[model samples]
Target: MCADYLLELASQLEFETVSACDTRDILEQLLESLAEHSAVTDIPVDEVVLANLHLALHQLDAIARGRGRPAINIPFHVIEGYLLHGFNVKEISELFGVTRQTIHRRMNDNGLRKSDVYSALTQEELDAVIGEIQQSHPHTGYRMMKSFLQARGLLVQTTRVRDSLRRIDPIGTEVRALANRTLRRRQYSVPAPNAMWHIDGNHKLIRWRFLVHGGIDGFSRLIVYLSAATNNRAATVLEAFIGAVNKYGLPSRVRSDKGGENMEVAQFMVESRGENRDSHITGRSVHNQRIERLWRDVYIQVLDQFHILFSNLEREGMLNPDDEGHLFALHWAFLPQLRRQLAFFMDAWNLHGLRTAGSQSPYQLWASSRHHEDPDQVEADYGIDWEGPYGFDDLGHQAGQVEVPQVQLQRHLTEEDMARLPDPNVHFMDAIDIYKATLQQLMQPRSEVDEGGSDA
Candidate 1:
């Protein structure tokens, strides 16, 4: 019976019914007796050993039946944060890698609850939405913030959003609410994203190095096109404007400040869209607030560092403000880098969540609001989504992929014209190649060669 019991104990280990931690002495006595009886007559097997075995098996059996399975525990704050970010329970479960039952239990245990109103209005979404507005247009007060959110399908109480804005940015809330209690402001409206576009040039950095020209859809606030060129010429602006038109299809109206640099754009809009239709409107820069507002963020977010760097270079005598060659080198070298920064800003701005145009990013607004008018939803309208928000069906519009169509319209140009056109979207390696070649030529010490390409 002792040997049979020992065999049974060994068999239990094979079937994984043993708990090594709980029954650490499972074989202690069996091994001691075996060692003591080595090379001698077998010691009589006894109930003491059998009793110990029975106790060990009982302990192992209890552990095997007990509930000691590994647990899945996620922090309450983490779930709360997800709820605050407008994630539904399903979404949170997927994020936490847990079941809905587990989530519900956790919520109940933590004394947290999400109401039906929370699911519908997404109050946490409002907090984020208002925060985005305060960030982009810091001067926007709480009342306007409420109107903005309500306009964009977020129907939150004014008091609620007001409190959120105050919480998110107390200083901005106090300062904006206190200042400009009354100011004359023109009413602005656009029926849709491509209904009208506002274009302008940012000259704040003109003294530093490059000039940035950009266009924004009035409704969606999408940065249609942003490019930097060395000169603020009419042709340059026209080229970018046309590029935008080709990419986004043509806008119903193009608004700009009455700068001569925009003459070509105005003419193009008038010619393409017709002057009788009010296709182009020129006014004071202040009246063209759509694109003007974009410049503030662009300068602060992207160009500020470059401005300081350039200013320091000039002040330190590393770059002479008067040297034509120095300016040329600056243009050739820094222009590409500036274009990249502008590209990043364009993407960041276009994809940034908006306060006024719903919580949707500019690109999202553009996608949803573009094709709401023309019933030819099954087709293209200069690549337009006419007849109501016929967004990209084949593939979603990526933020960084916003580019003007390179379709050379029905026009003829010489090689000189083509070469004179700025390629802001040039490949990085190609620019580096040209940069090195240009640097080599500029830095060449040609003491041995004469002007005639011969030794003097």
Candidate 2:
């Protein structure tokens, strides 16, 4: 159906065999020539035709915006006419609702004025370098090439090297951070909401420091936006929690790190707490857990995304050339859009993304319960006779004891895996130290005092 509709629409577009010279002439003079051509043609359009054209043009405008294309105000009528004549300046101006002179001036203003005279490597030198690369590391990209050249006393920017390679061969750069690692998946399944949730902060400094409070439902893996703020104050966190509670309703509980600030955050004193109590309903309290493993993963993901977003924006020159103020403005203005995009990502993660355990998404198990059983037919299902299971029933329910493994996880259990110990305080440096200490203890038959209790 969609394909047929697109084909039908394509058939309606009038095609013209524009002369090559005409196209070149239009390109040379741009909109100035188009306006001149229109004046000579004496073609007049009414308001209705103009309005319909404007509406149609809006669709394209939306596409451009979605593509991260910069916005400009230009005259649509002239630009539309120019496009009809094959992307002439007059039509572009009309589309932007700006004059031809204004459009041209703005284009020049934003355009890169850098000279192409790269001085570091001449064409012959570049060829020789490429030959060496092909001989040594044939598969290396421009970044590797840049590093290789630097070691050989060639002062060439990676960008310059990349550009040169593009001219000589099909070359592309795959942006990757050195610190990235593939983490083994550890899945946790909770039978109900409040069983568990992952919480972490994504911090950034565009102009001012900002933190995004993110929490993922353990069962559904649905993300709950606790808050996003310019400051990482206790109050800011509280406000975010309030917002999340208001949206998702209070979960039976929340699990987070035992950071000093969060430990002191009295949710009842917060506005959301008062409001919920005023409605005469009880609210859930926050729960702490040894889920540092999950928080570490969450923090890395948030920081990675932040770096990728801004890095791309900066590299693409989406940042303002004159004043850096545009960074803050652009980021804040796009905050809502970012949130929506995050939601889309979360959905993808929950539905299709593989997990560490059984390689299944959280959403898969969420829809079906593993231990579901009918309560009514307890006796027959259990296969308990009238006297109960032979041994237990005949013995007349003797009082017996069963030992339970205390919920405390054993510390430094294995020699080689001692470094896996978790820190109670959730401090990054402390966590690393604890991990190393545990690994040492596991590898050697030695015991150390729990630093968490002794230090703090």
Candidate 3:
């Protein structure tokens, strides 16, 4: 009776000749008609036979939809699991009793291709790992992300990491594209740690401007020092340079932009070397690309994060831009935090391994190179005094502040100190005059009383 019933249903639907696209619809119609017109007792329906018929229908539907070959009823999810577990199309075809073409077609149609570098984990597991990596290092690229994961004992391929990044952190993907677009193909190298150093300033903050003067060793990319100051004055630049020199002798050559802020430092370096041989003052900022690139990392790690917070606070009217005190107050609140964060970033950057540098950190590279150089020849070449604390009395004197040894160790100079610092050149003098004028304008009374009349 079940066979007779099935044959009757097939006759009504013409199942033998139905196109693939219309198979699912036709099958549904047949089932509905049978349910409506026949009773279970009349048809004597058997679950196994009905299931086989449904499987056949599904296979026909898949073939008609151009998803795979006809007469194969293996679920796409099962095939995906096989591919994910290191099974190839040929093996899967033999296992499923289907041709390799059918397996390939099904896999491609269902988006089950193993496009990533082989990882032993399931898709869900890989996604979870990628998500964790993105959360930890939001600005890191796929290569670095893969390294970080490998460090955690998960051997993931770079291609897989890139795919994960594309799915989970599209913004970072775009950021990477923009970063690469701006890259120049120039190559630079140095033989030793103190061969050359690059210095620059960053002004990415809104209300208050801060100086980020840092030096990167040309050979090892070791960060000599990263200092923040309230103003980008010549003295501020010198202070940062002195901080680096005090810790690790002088660089043979110092490089910086032609900005007036670096003029005095450049002069000092040339004076120390007793010639222009050690000073590289270029008009183009890109020539100091080493330090310029360092700023990009700081922008991602520090400036951009704080900018978002401070911007939100400003929009909410909690911070008053009109009040001069508000600026210094927030500076005091934020600059110390920024300094601490930058110190951490410096240590992490110096210690983190780089593939190009033979998988050694900048510090390791510098240390190894230092071991090879003769101490006397090195000291003579750079002419480093290597004596008592490198003096920054000039900064204090020029800024009209008492040279306090203890305060010198502090991260930032007081606003009063910055205000008293002598203007380096005509442009600085103009800025000072404008600032004074603005203050005077703000301090003037808004309303005046008449001499012979009551207050109006």
Scored by TM-score, the top model is 1
Q: What is the full ranking by TM-score, best candidate first?
A: 1, 3, 2
Better of 1 and 2 by lDDT: 1
Error of 3 at 103 (Å): 56
C-alpha lDDT of all candidate models, in order: 0.61, 0.41, 0.59
Question: In what order do the candidates fall by lDDT, top score first?
Answer: 1, 3, 2
Tens-digit lDDT track of model 3 for 225-284: 887767767787788787676556676677665677777778877776556354544434
- Weakest ten-residue segment in model 1 by summed lDDT: 398-407
lDDT of 1 by residue, 243-316 (tens): 77655668777777677788899898878766465677765554566776677667765677667767876887
Clashes in candidate 2: how many? 27
User: Which sections of candidate 1 miss by over 4 Å?
Assistant: 1-187, 372-443, 447-456
TM-score of every model versus the real structure:
0.47, 0.31, 0.46
**Candidate 3 vs. true structure, TM-score:** 0.46
